[model samples]
Target: MNVLLGLSASNGIGIGKAFVVPESEKRVISSKKIKAEDKPKQLERFERSLAKVTGQIASQLDAVKGDKVQSEIFETYFLMLNDPEFLGDVRKSFEASNHSIEYILNQKTEDYADRLRSSGNAYLSERAEDICDIFGRVLNDLLDFHPFDIEQVPDDAVIIAKSMAPSDTVILSKRRIAGIALTDGGVSSHVGILARNYGIPAVFDIENILDEIKTDALVIVDGTSGEVIESPDGVALSYYQNKITKAKEHADKLKVFRDKPAKSADGESFQLMANIGTVDEARVAMEEGADGIGLFRTEFLFMSEANHAMGAVHSKVAAFSEENQFNAYKRVLETMRGKPVTIRTLDAGGDKIISSLDVQHSSSEEKNPLMGLRAIRLTLANPSLLRTQLRALYRASVFGNLKIMIPLVTSVEQVEEVLAFAEKVRDELKSENIPFDENVPIGVMIETAAAAMISDCLAKVSDFFSIGTNDLTQYTIGVDRENALVAPLYDEFHLAVLRLLHKTIKAAEAEGIPVSVCGEMASRTESVMVLAGMGVRTLSMSPKLITSVKELLSKMSIDELKAISSKRLNSL
Candidate 1:
């Protein structure tokens, strides 16, 4: 047996026959010179191929309708197909080249993908993969060849791929594939996120496994440990089989904690909440027994192509309108059944560039987007957009408990501005005879260094505080979490970040307002202990992590957590 070690992405175990997915990037295309007079016919052929690929994506979208995240991903494929700039470049290339449409299209798309890969931005780099996926689909249509069909993949078979696009992951998820092992992906890649959301076992960064392992070989994927056992002998197979049985038993045990109230051994009660990005995830939060929805990322409402978030600024399709946002927010609030739902306003820009909002910036790249106009800065500049979201939120408030949390709040002035605008929205709704919770609380996200330093001032005006450890660590440590060169330095446990967390929590406590940690740090055991010890009673994270964190909380007393927190603060 040959064992391979890689990064553990999704936690689970799977034993099945290996199915090697074909790599579209390896396709060979030979240039066929075309006459200038035949340019019209060539362009028509390209249009036909584009249409066919678009139809396939639409079908995929129909299959995964309720999954807002997956549906949006497929919609992005539509936008990529209809991207005016890319299409213009293709036309220009066709005019300049004597080669076939396939050759020119491939060359231009590769150039675009290469530029994105070298952009030093993780979000854009992933978009490069999406671009390649779109290109492959179109090329397949043009060449009239279908090498692999995902639906034909055997049920519960382990999928082995060099790399998987978001669309491929969505399709494979429907079949309930046994597991996924990839040579190119990480914990935060789009495919990785999908695998976790779908509750599938996944291992990433398994270099050269595709070359060594053959199709239909018996494979054991231990996603919890990032181990892939190929052609295991009798002993190893028996051992893994036992492990799988125990894992199933452990999962069954976890269900007991699902409906239990979150409390420590010392009788210290806490709120275990879920951070969700879609209405569907809010339902998951309920299923996972989350006390509330801690961080409701509203960007998906705008980022989804169906919402016209990706169209041109003046596209006939409007962006996430007041009605669209209201229905989405109302559904999530109702799903929680009166449980508190903290919804953050549209946090576009930075890594998330909403095409409709920043048409100019999307065309002309920004050198330092993360630190540039983003979050509150971007929304405040576009008052109509921010006001529209506020109107929708307040209109949906009557459905259930709701709190508005503003992202990247660097100043008390910013907090006051949002509060003022929100009041005006409520007033307008009241004048129009619309019902809403007049006392809906507005909160601040302690994500920036400035926000943490001035937390006390912010707490005086804000209703509550939610520490976004991801951005707080990035801003405090002056490191981009996605940059491989500096990722090791982007420590969430850094002394400065912990101190900031403590400071923010203290500030909120002094003001008699609630404080919470809603980041990846909150999902980890050790980090949860430290945060709880630091006076954070509300810990919000992924829905899948809630039960595990609740179980850990139940095992430790308040005193033990305080001691752990003290040691971490003093040493690290």
Candidate 2:
């Protein structure tokens, strides 16, 4: 048997015939050099070529029988082909180079690939390869050669690629292929994540997997251990077969917790909510028995190039909370609807800055972005962005239990500013005869020492408090979480951090504002009891952690938690 060997790298299982786009053949052409007169013709030619290539890929995907993966893969490619940025880049390059459409496209792809390969950053290098692969496939379609259709691959063939994009990986049929081996990719790449989600055995960043592994090789991929055995002996094959079986069984067991209530053993209940970024995730959260969405990051809505929030924004937001049986906000008006979905409005700044907003706001690379204006500070500075978000939230409120929570509030004044802006937006909506819940409660995320220290004052003014322990710990300990040298000092369990948390919880309790811990610490079993003892009633975390946290909660009591909280406070 032809043997293929490479590290089990990506996040999934299954395989297909590899579609390799040679990186050396890629070229980049500068867009600035093209004469203005030739721009329109070049763009027209580029667009036609793109459409033709997309059509060819679509046709090939349609020819594949019973291959669900292949279908998803082509669909994503279609999305990318239609993406404004991709098309715009082609046009820009054509305009600058004053070259023929093919030359411009080829040069652009090559330039991108070359820059990526030469970059010191490994992640950028892999991303560059994905770009080349995508454009190369498009180019191949335009050139009349179908780049290795999925229907052409024999069943049980393993795909070998110089690199794979996440979108490309998603389209492969999971049942047909044995596994995947990449010549280049990283653990954090989109392809890797998609692989994990699909439970397909994958290995990435294998230095020469493509060179070593031939087509139709019966290579054994050990995803759990990141190992690949070439033409494995009977002993290794048997071991992997057993492992695959066990993994499937374990997955089934995890699914059992889906519909069950996430209550602790001692009958003390803590809300288990999902942190989601999209409407798709919201559906998954409901299926997973999430009490509500703990965090619906709104940045995803603003990801498009358009400054205006999309037209479907309200409908999309409503879908998450409205029409659901356990809508928390309606059940407990003070909280959010069917399992309250607490939303932090556009927490941009730091690494989350978008280029579009940066250009409008004239945001330069800050010497210390972490310490600079960000989150609430940035929003407060640009009231227009803040107002737009408030309007969207107000419009979305009529659909379900929607609560607004402000991030990085360092003082009472900041809280006042956000509230003032929110109230202003509410009034405008009312004047416009728009329906909105005027009493929709607002909360503050206790992420900074300033916010934590004055939690009592903030609690009195706000409806609730969510302890953002991740930033709280980092800010209190005066250590950057991303700084490798001082990362060890970014401990959540530090006495100062613990004390601040205890103080914030006490302040919230004194003011009678319900408190929840909605950070990474909420997922930690060791920290749960302490948070519970500190009188925190809710914990919001990733959906994957819900069942495990529920299992832990089922074993603890409020009284015990309170005692632990007291002990920690006294010792501190």
Candidate 3:
């Protein structure tokens, strides 16, 4: 048996035909080169090439048939193909340089890949491989090369590629694929996220796996421990097979709790909701017994645009509403159809760059953008953009159980302003004789200290409050969670942050408005117990964590939780 040794980086395993990276010549251009007149033609060629490649991928998706995971991969590519900034950059680079399209595209891709890798942001760095992979495939498609067939790969093979794009990962169906080993990528990459979603084993950043591992090698990927054993002896093979069996058994146990209610031993029932970004995720959440979608991050629909346009923004919302109108909303409504799917409006700002915003003339380049103008503050300032999103949410409400949520609301006035704007949209729709639900519940994300402190007042006007503890803890403790330098200070267990959470939950309780926690903290086993004691009525988190949280709740008594909370609070 062919054998190769490497590390397993993700949970699932795959064995498949290897898509080796093809060699290409890198062309370089000097600034002193003549021919300014040739710029437009080069740009036109580049745009046309991109459009053609997108068309090809779409055609490929149409032809392939397997599973949702595979379909998502193709859909992600379609989104990238239509990305305004991606295409616009290609055009800009071509116009400014006197290099061949191949040279320019490769150079740009490499530069971006390097920047992402070096930036220390796992998500951005992982996406770098995707950028290169997508561009390379697009270029190859332009050159009349047929991409690999998804249906023909052997059922139990691991796919070894130089790198993988988000689109490439999306197109793969989970049933056929087992594990993934890549020469490039990291934990935060698109491939990594996709792998996790698919529940497949993956190992990334193994720089030379493509050159070392032979095709059809019998490799065992251990995702939990990040190990890869190649061409194992019978003893080792038996060991892995037994390990996989045990893991499956554990997963099966979790699945048993999928349909059970999340209730504390003392009989306090709380909604276990899911935080989702797309329609595909909506399906998964419903399958996993999520009460409702707590955070429907609408930003994914807007991020493709380098310059956020009102018309484009409206269309994206319309499309999301239209495509998902029947199923996405219907699933939540049917599951708890009459209950609420609290959709948080776009929280754009900080590190999330809105391509259309003019940042050159801003007062100061924010030294720390994450804590800067973001969420409701940024949205309120951009009235037109905010209005477009509000209109979409208002329109979507007619289809099923929907609620409007404003992110990062610090004051009563900000909440009132958003409510007023939402009312305007509802009135306009009514005037137009458009079908909609005018009385959709409005809520606020209590993420900042100001928002949490005055949550009682805000709760009076709003229907509910979702505690965004991720930001709350970050701001409360004055520590950036992403900054390793002060990571130890980023503890959610800090008495100040816990007390603030308790205060916010109590405030919402006093006002008779339901409260929930929708952050990383809500998903933690230990944190769930604390939140229960704090009187949180809901816990919204990643769907994968739902079963465990529910199981944990089933084992714990509310009285015990309250006792712990009382002791913790007294110590403070």
Say which candidate scores most in TM-score: 1
Q: What is the C-alpha lDDT of each candidate?
A: 0.85, 0.64, 0.68
> How many clashes (backbone atoms < 3 Å, residues ≥3 apart in a chain or on different chains) does model 1 have?
0
**All candidates: TM-score:** 0.93, 0.69, 0.75
lDDT of 2 by residue, 1-572 (tens): 23444445553334334433333433343335556686676566566777676676556555652333344344434444555655677777666655566666777777766765564334445546656767876665444444444344445656566765543553444345566667766654666655665556787656766566665455766565666556667776676678778766866776777777766557766677777654456666676677887777665444422212122221012112222312322332223335577778777665354433332441223545567767887877767667777776777677777778898888888888788888888889888998887877899889989898888788878998888898888778888654435656788888888988988888987888878888988988879878877777788887766776776777777777778777777876
Colliding residue pairs in candidate 1:
none
lDDT of 1 by residue, 256-310 (tens): 9899999999899999999988888888899999999999998777766453423
TM accuracy, model 3: 0.75
Scanning candidate 1 in windows of ten residues, the lowest lDDT window is 309-318
lDDT score of residue 20 within candidate 2: 36
Best by lDDT: 1
| Model 1 TM-score, 2 decimals | 0.93
Provide C-alpha RMSD values for all models, in order.
2.6, 7.2, 5.7
Residue 357, candidate 2: C-alpha displacement in angstroms: 8.7
lDDT string for model 3 (264-344, tens) is 877788899999765557767888888888888765545433112222422122223333333444454445455567777
Report lDDT (Cα) of residue 268, candidate 3.
Answer: 80
